[model samples]
Target: MNDKVKALLSILESAGFSHDDLAGTVAELNDAVNDGKSTSIQLVSPGAAARYIKRINDENVFTARFRHSDEPDLLNNESNDERIENPNQDSCIVVSYDPAKQ
Candidate 1:
């Protein structure tokens, strides 16, 4: 696995994504990145990767039950898959959600 795959897997794990569906998600994400649909996620770049991962968890077959409601809307500006570079500044500042309220 390349850095993208590793980053994806790490994000998935942190968000508690479904293990059963990971293999397919990994393959799909990898393909998306390779095919110009999605890009590699960066964990060290001021929460850009983390935000993107949260959005992925909300959508698609591999659902994240504990998904964040206030996830930053970074995808809207993401025409291609690359680090947003301090995404929190360019993105919406949605407030955090309560896990118990969900």
Candidate 2:
């Protein structure tokens, strides 16, 4: 296996996947590739992948809010518990994981 494949397998193993499961998945993937099908895999940090797994298994949600401004004073005010309404940029995202719902 190439370095990338080896790295992915290692990550999966570390994430508590069984050897037999990995082998079966690899076989299926190989079959797909041989049949001229395209596949895509994303590599992420171990911590991020672990968090994703935990969220999915626990059926949890992750939410985050971000604000951006070119002014230094605005950022400093934000840290002081001041709300900057309608800043230069603001965004909020919510992600929920529930395989059963899918």
Model 1 agreement with the true structure over 12-80: per-residue lDDT tens digits: 555554556467646666665555453322222223434554554454322222213344335355434
Report the alpha-carbon TM-score of model 2 versus the true structure: 0.32
Tell me, by TM-score, which candidate is best.
Answer: 1
Which pairs, if any, clash in model 1? 39-81
Q: How many clashing pairs in candidate 2?
A: 0
Candidate 2 local lDDT, 1-64, one digit each (tens): 4333344455456656556756755554444444444433222222234444443334322111
List TM-score per model, in order. Answer: 0.34, 0.32
How far out, in Å, is residue 53 in model 1? 5.7
lDDT of each: 0.43, 0.37
